[model samples]
Target: MADLFDNINDWLMQEALDENPLTSIVETFGRRLVEGGVPVARISIGRSILHPTIGLLDVQWEQDTGQVNTQAVPRQIVRNSLEIFDTPFGELSKGKTDRLFADLRDPDEVARFPMFEQLAARGMTYYAAFSRSFGRTHHLYERISNEFRGASLSFTTKRFSGFSQADLDGLERVLPAFCICLRMDIERFVAGEILETYLGKISGKQVLDGQVERGDGQEIDCAILYSDLRGSVTLSQTLDSTAYLDTVNAYFDCVATAIDEHGGEVLKFIGDGVLAIFPFDEANRPRANMCAAALSSAQEAFARAEHANRGRSGDGLPALHFGVGLHVGTVIYGNVGTARRLDFTATGPAVGLASRCEGMTRELDTPLVATGAFAEHCPRAGADLGQHRLRGFADPIALVSYPLT
Candidate 1:
């Protein structure tokens, strides 16, 4: 336990201080408590969580009142912790004691967690948890919980051996260091929010550490937008390698610029094409972000293409254009590939749909086209182009997109 606390303090000073400090501080503490033998812990930024889009979540973790469940008196109730969208899900797991892989052999589980009967098959029993808050955005909540079977020091054996009390005291001593870094996180979150709102977005890249908080460098549901320079292939064939790269880079500049303008993160570029993400945020859904960004990027790309073609004195050639596609649904969004090397790209059904949309941009004589889902939520969804029966999908989807404005 002493070693674990020392590690937490060191991480608090190091990893906790980053572009977004509050989130790092909370995660640091939550994970440390898990390793501390508390088995289970949680940080409640407020008594519960209250937000508009949380309709799908209804669980004990959501802070409804400052009363702190005086109605229940949870095993280890700490107040004013971090606020997260997934809090209810984790709390349900712990409160219901459904996650214990060790407590299955114990009889207490039958009375305490009838729902966790499957847990005993896996060998688990009861769990312990701790929670607290930090940072100016005291809304930040973090929790740590773990389980037990009939293993280790039982409740009856604790009186005969004094090690349990000693261990808890050691954990208490280590908690203060985490508190220090949490203070810094609070300051940074407030300062950064104020600065950005006042000065405007300082960096061209999108800011998304908040949305990806739970992604431990792995894949998730995200809208991926791919934009390719249609005429670049022909242009590159005529130019030297250096000139080709310069031309491609110029097109990349335009695509990336539009993506950032509409709150999308550029993940990578494939030669003349660029891949980016319209990640879900506190305000908007994933479907909305994807269509808005695709429409914006297409307009931006076409404008630049026309301007460049005119500047080049294209006496007989058609103005350059881009084929763009957007599809919404689950796609892997983490670092996946070789163990030594990986790329944070989404794959699966949605990506294929996006590819089909891009193909339609060329066939339909339009710069922007998206799958059916985009029309459902996009703020600027204009008209339906018609239904498309993609090669693999079981049902034909209604393709929709906006005319470049």
Candidate 2:
């Protein structure tokens, strides 16, 4: 048993440096315990995570199938659920107990927790749960308590005699090392989630792939879509701060959702405006496909805003009005800004032109406008609004308007 634990510790140390995913680590650890004669039928590990959408991460490994399953509990669900307090893991996390052991075969002991009864019904005879702290807490810790403070590990067995003293002692001795490995992987995961949240998916991956230096970028041809909310200044002046923020978020949800669904990346939100792109890849995504996707996204954004406006009107709130512009051109996409504060985004004349096209929507009294470069790709031609000299550009550019149906 001592030698088995030593091997597990050595493997865990290497894994800490390798930073493999937490799921794979937990699955292998459970298998190792079973091979060492621990008779573990199931192992579950739960820990709080710092994510915009997810509050908790749960990983379960079952010896019967030698498979691991993972679940990401949403922040709202975790906040409202009282069921956590009824489990042994909940008791350990609350600091009411450091460890829990139950003889599942004993009716009285099985009745101690709802989980014990479930495990006994599944033919498990004994169960043990342990808590390990990562020694760090954040704002979420105040709301969820010890749940956000660290991790909880539970092991269940079908063995008639349950886990012996030696098995429990071995686990107690090895748990710290295992937790250290898990923390390493978790930190990496959190970093990625934050980056992806702040930066678009493509840009975030580039940063993670070691493209962190300022001015590190690549020139690429893509279709750019820019949309701005109309009368935002007046809305801001009339509405309170909270109400104005909610309104802006609602507008963003409409535009961003449409862009994402049409295979575009929302690069940034500049006040009331959104800048997004659908890259043109000759191998995977053709130029026409990207341009069409950008146009479709603009149409969908208008449709979503119209639906939202109907609800707002019923509630005696102002309707939402927005304009979208589409253009296709080459732009530099990558990191920019100060050494300390970098922003991953797209920049160039094409991006400027796309914004200008959106600005033209107000003058033309249209909801959607596209440059000739973008309109050329559409199967159905748009009504040409004639060549007009746009601001910042000396040459007159041809523009077209699409009918949002």
lDDT of 1 at 347: 64
Q: lDDT per residue, candidate 1, 225-293, as tens digits?
A: 777778776776787887667667767666777777777666667767776667665366555656566
Highest TM-score scorer: 2
Task: Give the alpha-carbon lDDT of every model.
Answer: 0.51, 0.87
- The TM-score, computed over Cα atoms with residue i paired to residue i, of candidate 2 is 0.96
Candidate 2 per-residue C-alpha lDDT over 62-89 given as tens digits, one digit per residue, 9 for 90 to 100: 9999999999889887777788657776
Models 1 onward score TM values of: 0.45, 0.96
Candidate 2: Cα lDDT at 360: 97
Segments of candidate 1 deviating more than 4 angstroms? 1-219, 284-290, 314-319
The per-candidate count of clashes, in order, stands at 49, 0
